[model samples]
Target chain A: MRNFFVLAFVALTALALPSVAMAQSAATSAASDGNTSGVITVIQVDSETNLVGFVLSTQNGELVEVSVNDSTSFGLENAAGDRWVSDFGEDPTEALLRITDQRERFAPVTVTVADGVASAVVDREQGDLERNLGFLFAIYIVTWAGFFAYIFIVSRRQSDLAREIKALTSQVG
Target chain B: MAALPKIRLIWLGFTAALMALTLWMVFLWVPTEINQGNIQRALYFHVPVAWTAMVAIVLIAVASVAYLKTRDEKWDRLAVAGAETGVIFAALMLITGMVWAKPVWGVWWTGEAKLTTTLILFFIYVAYLMFRAYFPPGEQRRRLAAIIGLIGAIDTPIIYYGAQLWERAHPSAVVGPYSNNDSSVDGPVGLTLLVATIAFSVLFVYVASERYRLRKQEDEVMALRRAISLQALRVATTSDSTESISSAPAGGA
Candidate 1:
C-alpha cells in the first residue's frame, strides 16, 4: 500500500509536469508591456474636444485613464464568445463607438496604451480575474481538505479498532 | 485488519489521478467564459460535487432499502458510509455554489429554485448523518436510519427541478420554459464539466468505499469485544458456582 501511494504520487507529478507548456498565458501576456487589463469604470466622450477616453480599474485598484482615437484598433467580444474587431488603421466606429453606446458599465477590457493613448482596445470577456482565481483556488482547497481530513480520521479509527479486535480475540481464545 | 480491498485501492488511485487532471483542465485549459468570466470555472467543481452528492443520497436510499429487505448488516454498513460521504459532498456543493454566486449573482445566496432545493438536500443529508451518529446502535437504529435514508432522497429531484419549478431569475434550465430566455447562465455543461463530473464521481465512490470498509472492520471489532465479554462472564459465573459449591456444607444447600 505504501509503495502504491509513492508510485501514484510520482505518476501524478509526472502527469502535472506536462501541463506547463500548455498553460494559457493570455491574461498574463496581456498584462505585460504597456497594456492594461481591467473593468471599465467610466467612459468619457468629449465631442467638444473630439476626444474619447475611459477610466480603467486594474486588479491592483489603480485607475488608469486611456484615450481612444479613430486610428485605435477595436476587438469586441460578447458573452457568447462572438467577436468583432478592426485593425489599428481601420475605423473604430463599427466596433468601439457603437459598443461604447450600448455596453454595460464595468465591462472587462485590455487596452494597449502607448503614453496613455489607446492603440488597441480589446473589449472581451476578461472576468474578475483575481477574485475568480481566488475563488477557484479556495474551492479546490476546500474539496481536498475535506477529503483528506475524512480519510485521515477513518484510517486512524480503523487501525485502532483493528488492534483492539486482535487483542480481544487473543484474550477470548 | 485496516487493509483496503484491492478494488477499493484501485478506485482511490484512479480518483486521485483523475481529480488532479480535472483540476488542471479547470484552472488552466478551459477558457474564461465570455460573460461570467473566470468564476464560470466554478461550474467544473460545483456541478460535479453536486452530482456526486445527489448520487450519494440515492446510494444511501438504495442501500437502506436493500438492507431492510435482506436484513443484511453489509447493506446497513453501506448506508452509513453513504450518509457520511453524502454530507461532505453536499456541504461542498452548497459552499462552492455560494462562492460561485458571490461574483456573478452579486450575493452570497439567492432564493432561486435550484439553489434552494440544493440547500434542502444538504440539510437532509446533514439530518440523516446526525441521526445515524447520535442514535443508539441496533436493529431499531438501522431501521429508522434506513427509513430516513429512503425518504431523504426525495429532495434530489426537487433540486433537479428547481430551475423549472420556480427559478426564473438568474439561470434557467436547458429544457424548461426559461431555457429560451436571454438568461446568460451556463448549463448544458461542456466537455470540462463532463470531465469534472467523472472525476468527482470516482472520488465519491472511493471515499464511500473506504468508509464502508472501515465500518465493516468496526463491526468486526465490536462483535469480537462482545463475544469476549460474554465468554468472560460465563467463565466467571461457572467459577463462582464451583467455589460456592466447594465451600458449602457437605450434602447441604
Candidate 2:
C-alpha cells in the first residue's frame, strides 16, 4: 500500500507537468526572441504627442511611457497563431484600442521601444518566463520530497524488523 | 552492534546540517548561469543524487564479489542494502532529471544515451531487490544475486562515460578526469556541486548502513527460526524412540 502511494505520487507528478512544460517552452521562446514583456498598464494615444504607459516584467514592474506617431504600428496575433503588424491607415487609434483591450488587464505584451518611439508591440497571453524559477523549485521539491518519504518508509520497515528480531531471539533463547 | 546505531545517528545529523548548507548555497549564494538562468540551479541537487546513485551501484558490485569469495552473509547483506538504497536514489535522479529537462531541453524525456543508461541502471537495481525478496533464503539466492550484481556493474561504467562516448544531449563530464572546457563548472558553481555531493554521500551511507542493520536482523531471525525447528524435531524423535522402548515387551517379560 505504501508502495502504491509512492508510485501514484510519481505518476501524478509526471502527468501534471506536461501542460506546464508546454507553457514553459512557449514562454521561454518568447523571452529568447528578445522582446520586452509586460502589461500595457495604461495608454494615452492621439494624433499629437502620443504616449503609452507600460510596465515591464522585471521585479520592480516599472511603468514606462513610450511616444508614437499616428503612423506607428501594432502587432497582433490572429486565430491561426500568426502575428501580423497593424498599419490600419492614418490614425493608429484602433490599434491602440486593440492593445488596451484584453480579457486580463495584466495580460503580458511584448514591445520594442527605440528612442521613446514604439517600433513594434505584440500581446503575450502566456507571459515571458525565461528565468523559469518555477521549474527549479519543482525539481527541488521532488528531489527532497522523494528523499524524505523514502526515509520515513525505511525507518518504519526497520522498526518492524527490529521487533521481529527481538521476538525471534527470545524464542531461540 | 551497539556503536553502529550511534554512528548512524551521527552521520544523519551531519548529513542534515550539510544539506541545509547546500540548500542555502544553491538558492542564494551561487550566481545564475548566463544561458540556462535559474533553471541551471537544478544541477546543484541533480548532479549530487546522480553521483550517489552511481556510488551505490559500485558498492553493490564490490560487496557482491566479496560475498562470492568469502561466503560472508555480511557482504551479502551490504549488497542488498546498497541495492535498495540505489533504487531510491536512482528513482530520484530520474525524476529530478525529468523536471530539469522540461525547461532546459524543452522535453520531459528523450532517448539520449546517458539518460537511457541511467534508466537501465534504475531497472537493474529494482530487479536485484525483487530477486532478493522472492528467492528463497539460502546459498543459492546469495550466489545468484551476487552474479546478477556483478553483471549489472557493467552498466555503471557505460553510464559514467555515456556523454563522452555518445556525444548526445547530455553535457559531458564536468568535474571528472574526462571533463573539458566546453562543459566545465568553476568558482561558486563548482564548489556548490562539490558540497552537495558530499552531503548526499553522507546521507546515502547513513541510510544504507541502517538498511544493512535491518538485513542483519532479518538473517538472525531466519537462523533462529531454523535452529528452533531443528531442535524441536530432534526432541520429538528422541521422545518417540523412548516411548517405543517403554512399550516393548520389557526385555522379554
Question: Which numbered prediction scores highest in DockQ against the true structure?
Answer: 2
The Cα error of candidate 1 at residue B197, in Å, is 1.5
State which candidate has the highest TM-score: 1
lDDT tens digits by residue: candidate 1, B116-157: 876787788788778878998888888998988888776577
Q: After superposition, how far is residue A44 of candidate 2 from its true place, in Å?
A: 27
- Across residues A1-173, which tens digit of lDDT does each residue of candidate 1 receive? 44444565456445533433333343443234465777777767566533377788887999999887776766555655455545534554455454564347456676667888887676433334555566655665566667766777877777787788789889888
DockQ of every candidate structure? 0.19, 0.19
Local accuracy of candidate 2 as per-residue lDDT tens digits, A1-173: 35543664565456435533443443333232234556666566446734443444533576666655554555555445444444434445556556656314555565556777656565543222444568776887787678768766777777787787788778777
Number of clashing pairs per prediction, in order:
0, 0
Error of 2 at A142 (Å): 2.0
